[model samples]
Target: MNAEIIGVGSELLLGQIANTNAQYLSKQLAEIGINVYYHTVVGDNATRLKETIHTAQKRADLIIFTGGLGPTKDDLTKETISAVLDKPLVTDEEALQSIESYFKKVNRVMTPNNKKQALVMSGSTILHNNYGMAPGMAIKVSGIEYLLFPGPPKELYPMFENYAKDYLLSKLEIKERIESRVLRFFGIGESQLETEIEDLLEKQSNPTIAPLAGDGEVTLRLTAKHADSKQAKKLIDDVETEILQKVGPYFYGYNQTSLPEELMKHLINEEKTIASAESLTGGLFSERLTSISGAGAVLKGSIVCYHNDVKQHTLGVLNETLNNHGAISVQCAKEMAEQIRIKCCSDIGISFTGVAGPKVQEGKEVGTVFVGIAIEGKETVVHHLQLSGSRQAIRQRSVYYGCHYLLKQLKERD
Candidate 1:
């Protein structure tokens, strides 16, 4: 079934708060094979909300409303929807008792206006809110379904997961399950990755392939639908295998897993320890590694050798090599990686040295990066990249590249 989510709040339009409720509802609806085509955000005004409801009713089979279910004067979602659908508002006795008991437990006198929280449309399914005072409601009018939820995430999340999900599922005539898997890739641009799997995207029907780019990474979301969950998953797997045959080398992890998380997993699983020597990135690589749980067992330490003096004195980079080729060169990176590994007595050592700048450094243009990796009993590898972006972007992308290269090395060993 097709759906539309209407968020009722002025704070969303004014940028005071995000409309996270729409995002959550869209994902939940997608899992039940419901396609959400539009998300509409309206202020607490009754006229605008009624207009939005009219528009949603014309195009969508299911309309979900969030927010404006409170005790204050501005809370008008149920009243507006009742006017549009010609449904009278009635008080749910059990819900009224729950709200009254809550105020009694808190040792506060309950006001008469608070009774409005328990008011529901005349013929609707009451979704009791376990975490808050207002109860959510679901009703059907003129072959269209309407579900209302609270604005606060703490209350809305549980209400939808426990009650609203099953209510919608029961309304579906054909019970088709939808499954989606996101394949994450670094070191490849979105356009390039799309080109590599263009054929798969074109021929997709049961399982669809969509590419999305964010934070210097590309992800392909594979969604499949079937009555059998295992069959749906197999459809996605077959498409994934076909796509990966062309671009598997760049694929790092699946669905919500990041490069740092994947790297930490490999390190801890293989009983490997790593150390980092930073120059331009200023210990960002090490910081990313240590942010993951169980990092203490896998990360030895890091040396932020920003200046040439620190590289020579602390990391023991050869003064002659710095004098001849400079710190941004491959020679300095290789030496820094090897020396940090020796100093920390780690199984692997990685180094980030580059010109992430607004100005040229040592006659080199900005975004000239050199990453080095030295593994015990393996030949040291250094990568030279001429990147383009702001200083912060360059630095962040450099850290991602470091993780990518290290993952590649670990995969090769495996």
Candidate 2:
């Protein structure tokens, strides 16, 4: 069914808050093969909301709304919709009891206006709110279905997932399941990756392939639909296998898993401890790694040796090497990695030294980078990269490359 999302909040228009509810609902609707044609945002004005509803009613069969379900006077989402549908708003007994129970649990007296949170359109199917006072509703008027949800993400996400999802499924005549998988890749430009997989993109039908690029990484989302879920998954797997055959070298992890997460998982699984000596990246590599839980077990420590003297004094990098090759060289990077590994007594040492700027440094151009990796009982290796971007982008991409390189090393060891 075609759907239109109407977001009701002055905060959204004023840029005080994002309309994330529409994004969430659109994704949910897509999984059920519903097309979201338009997203309309209106402030707490009844006349404008009425006009918006009239326009949506002529185009869409399903109209979903978020926000304006609170105790305040501006909470007029239900009132406006009631006026448009010519339906009466009545207090839901179960919802009223839920609201009262919430106030009793908190040992606070329930205010009179709070009862407005329990009101729903007459003859509507009530959606229970497990997270907040405002229960949602779904009703049919003149062959059009209207779904209402509370604005807060915490309240709206659970209510839609627990109640509204099942209700929508029950209304569907055809039973179909959509299975989606995201393949994450690094060390490849988006255009190059797309060129390599052009054949797959062109002929895809059962499982559709869509490529997206962001933050020095590329992701391809593959979706397949079928009556049986297992069959749908198999279709996706078949397409994924074909795509991977061409570009598996750059591919790293799956849906919702990132380069840092993959690196941490590798370290934990292999029982290896690591340390880092940072230069231009300025501890970003260590920060990203430590953001994951249980990082302390695999991360011995890190040193932000931004200066040549600090690298020599703290991480034990040879002063002669720094003097001869300068800070942004492969020799300096190699010594920094090997020395930091020895100082921290870690199984692995990784170092990042780069010239991320608008100006050249020590005869090297901007975006010149050297990443060094040293593993116990293995020969030290350094990867030289000439990247392009702003200073912040260069620093962030260096951290991503470190994780990608570490994962590649761990996989090769196996």
RMSD, one per candidate, in order: 1.3, 1.6
lDDT of each: 0.94, 0.92
The 10-residue segment of model 2 with minimum total lDDT is: 170-179
Off by over 4 Å in 2: none
Alpha carbon lDDT at 90, candidate 2: 96
Question: Residue 167 CA error for candidate 2 (Å)?
Answer: 1.5
What local lDDT does model 2 show for residue 230? Answer: 91
Deviation of model 1 at 309, angstroms: 2.0
Q: Candidate 2, overall lDDT?
A: 0.92
**Tens-digit lDDT string for candidate 2 (1-414):** 789999999999999999999999988887876778999999999999999999999999999999999999999999999888888999999999999998999999999999999999999999999989888999988888899999999999999999999999988888687778999999999999999999999998889999999779999999898878899999999999998999999999899898999999989999999999999899999999889998999999999999888988878888888888899999999998999999999999999998989899999999999999999999999999989999999999988888888789889999
**Residue 256 lDDT (model 2):** 88
TM-score of model number 1: 0.97
The number of residue pairs in model 2 that clash at the backbone is 0
**Please, what is the TM-score per model?**
0.97, 0.96
